[model samples]
Target chain A: MSPLVIAFLVLALLICGSALSMLWTKNLLHAALAMFLTMLGLAGLYVLAYADVLAVAHLLVYVGGVLILILFGIMLTNQTNQTNQTNQTDTASSKNHLMTRESSRLLPLSIGLSFFLGLFWLFTKGPWMNNLPVTGDSKLKEVGLGLLTEYAFPFELAGVFLLIALIGATFVAKNHD
Target chain B: MTDIPVLYFLWVSAFLFATGLTILLLKKNTIFVLMGIELILNAANLNLVAFSKNDPSMQGLYLSLFVLVVGVCEMAIALAIILQVYRNYRAIDVDQFKSEF
Candidate 1:
């Protein structure tokens, strides 16, 4: 396999493994950490796909913005029990770690695996265009121009949407006392 | 120039989508479920980027850019709503919320 393929495989493993661990772990903090790794691997995958602009944006929005927001959410929403605190120090086990509850794993795993298999079979059977190789290069200029010209209206609308979301979020989160 | 096959990207995206579905179904934490939603969204975005890789019009790429913006907006608002829920109920688990009405 070429180096590019090797890199892609490695990044894919990182992403899938981290996401799996996120599913497996019950500790809320551990899941958050796994999500961080998953996002990192996804950024790498975006790079391999030659969407460098999207890769950077993914890194900034997910790694920098969303993860911090998640951590803050975790910190803010923890329900501390006085009884569990003593037991936690004595045992030093994950039982005391802020738990994020889940339903039975067996059913979900089976369902997910079956879904994945079905999709895999479908993808393999589909006649996707493979003869044409991508004219691989940085898409920064094309993407920028497209946003400014043809997609200018939607682009501006997105900015407005973002601003509205920000104001709405702050209003919603603020103490209503 | 051996561009990676679109099928490979599709396979990975499918795996991601399934995993996200599992998380959505299984996890009780609201934020955890939200993370799963993020995963599914990214999977779709990856598919768009992969398919548009060779297109001269690059429509998929442009769409993915807008998708990213929308995703961030959703995340912010969802977390805010989660914060409000936690304030009212003192819990973040989806099942933990009990309605008076």
Candidate 2:
């Protein structure tokens, strides 16, 4: 195997391992940290796929933007009991702050494993496998040019959509009464 | 160095999708479910990037970029909605919601 393949394998292991940990951990903070590692591995995989532009964008959008948003969500939605004031002291610890509840582990794990195996078998058996060599050049210029030229309209639409979504989000999240 | 096979990317993406699905079903917290949804979206984006790596038109890459934008927008809106839900319900756990009926 080439060095590129070795690197790919290493990144894949990182991604899969972290994702599994995200599933396994009950602590929301631990899951978030695992997700950070997963995203890093995914960015590396994007580089391996010759999508350097995407790697940077994914890192910026996910790590910089989305992860922070998620952390805020976790902070805001903490499950503190109002009726039981006495127990509040016990639950106030940092260790118990964001450890959200989950359902039974056995069924979910089995279902997930089955789905993965079925998809794996299907993918390996599928006729869509392509042997074409990957173009190792940086895609930054082509992607930028394409967005301005061929994809300009969609690009503008996405921008407008984003603005509307953000405004609507703020509106929805504001105090009403 | 030989190009990495597209199959490897597919395999990883498939695993991610499965994990996301499991998290969505197993977790009661709305934010955890949202994270699962993010995982699924990223898995799909990875597939697009991998496929476009060898294509001359590179259309998949462009689409994946748009996918990223949409995913972020969705995340923002969903989190905002979750915040609102917290205000009304006092808990973000999906199973905790109850109707007066």
Candidate 3:
């Protein structure tokens, strides 16, 4: 296999494996760690797609910002009754052997597998808009220009909305007690 | 056509969506459920990025950017609400919240 394919394979493996591990594990902390790795793989995949700007921003936001936020959440909402620190977050990895808490008798998994297979089939059969001209390398510059020019209004709106949301979150979190 | 196939990205996204759905069902912890939501968000983002790869106008990319911002806002609000819930209930397990009518 080519190096590009190999790289994609490795990153895909990390994303899928960590994500599956996140589902299988019962410990909240382990799932959070797995999520961090999954985000890392996703950032790498974005880079592979030539979205260097998105990759960097994804790394900054998901890995640097959101993961830290998750860790803090885990810390703040301490499961006080737990006797062991590792047990609180690491999940019961060994116990999850081929079985997890399924919501139904072969309904969700069967539906999911069918959906995946259908999508795969559609992808193979449909005429994808492939062979499009690759854009220039400097997406960071283009993104900067677009954010200031065409996307400026929406950008400002998002910022304002984010500010309001953060304030509201703090207000709701704070209690008189 | 460029040699880079979009199927790879689609495959990855499909697996992620599946995993996120599984997490939503399997995990009893409220925080775990939130992580599943994040996974679902990222899966959608992956699709946007993948599609945006071929678009010169970058609309999908722009939409995904907004989605990311919105996702962060959601994470913050949800975590705060979860903290409040923990404070009130002293537990964050979904199974623990049972009230017989």
Candidate 4:
């Protein structure tokens, strides 16, 4: 196989494996770690797609910013008595409660695998537009210009929305009086 | 020019999308669910970017860029809400939440 094909395979494995691990693990921390791997794999995929800028941005946003935010959210919202570890009398009951997950197990997995395979087959068989050629050495300049000229309004709106979200988050997570 | 078929990227995206959907449906933990949501969003974004690579207008690229923004917004808002819910209910499991007797 070509180097590009091998790279794609590696990325796909990383993404798929980490996602599966994220689903399999019950420990919140482990799941978070799995998510980190998934994001890393995704960034690599973006780079392979020739979206170096998007790859970098995705790494910054998802891994650096969002993952940290998620970790904080996990810490802040942690249930003190999850599985009620300290109470000896209720240990068995709490263990049962803590171990149980809300998923459909085999059904969902089978369904998901089927959907994926179906889509893959369709993609391979379908006739797509192939006459076009890829262009642009890098998108840093084009994107900057587009954001300022074409997407300026929405860009500013996103900023305002972020501010609102920050304020709203504080309000929502505040200690109950 | 060694141009790979666009279908390869589409297949990858589809697999990611399906895995994400399973996670969304199967996981009880709120954060886990959120991660799944992110996966689905990224899978779709990958599709858009892949298709846009060949397009003269590069529409899919722009759309993916905006999708990234929207995903962040959703993540921030959802995590904040999850934090509040945990504080109130003392549990992050979805099945624990019951509105009325």
Give the winner by DockQ. 2
**What's model 1's interface RMSD, roughly to a tenth of an angstrom?**
1.5
Q: Which stretches of candidate 4 lie over 4 Å from their true place?
A: A80-100, A130-136
Better of 2 and 3 by DockQ: 2
Among all windows of 10 consecutive residues in model 1 chain A, the one with the lowest summed lDDT is: A87-96
The better candidate by DockQ, 1 or 2, is 2
**lDDT for model 4, on a 0 to 1 scale?**
0.79
lDDT over C-alpha atoms for residue A126 of model 1 = 67
In candidate 4, position B14 carries an lDDT of: 92
Which window of 10 residues has the lowest lDDT sum in candidate 1 chain B? B1-10
Between candidates 1 and 4, name the one with more favorable DockQ: 1
Task: Give one digit per residue, the lDDT tens place, for model 2 in B1-101.
Answer: 67888888999999999999999989988888998999999999998998887788899999999999999999999999999888986888888967879
State every prediction's TM-score relative to the real structure: 0.93, 0.93, 0.85, 0.87
Ranking by TM-score: 2, 1, 4, 3
Question: Over the stretch B12-82, how does candidate 4's per-residue lDDT look in tens digits?
Answer: 78978998888887888888889889999999999887877776566787778778877887888898888
As a TM-score, model 2 comes out at: 0.93
Clashing pairs in 2: none
Superposed model 2: Cα runs more than 4 Å off: A81-97, A131-133, B99-101
lDDT of 1 by residue, A1-177 (tens): 878778889989998999999888877889899999989998888888889999999999999999999989888887765435656665557343877678888898889899999988887776766444445788799888888999999999999999999999999999999
Clashing pairs in 1: none
Give the CAPRI rating of model 4.
medium
Q: Give Cα distance to truth, residue A163, candidate 3, Å.
A: 1.1
Q: In model 1, what is the error at residue A169, expressed in angstroms? A: 0.2
- What range of 10 consecutive residues in model 4 chain B has the weakest lDDT sum? B1-10
True interface contacts retained by model 2: 0.85
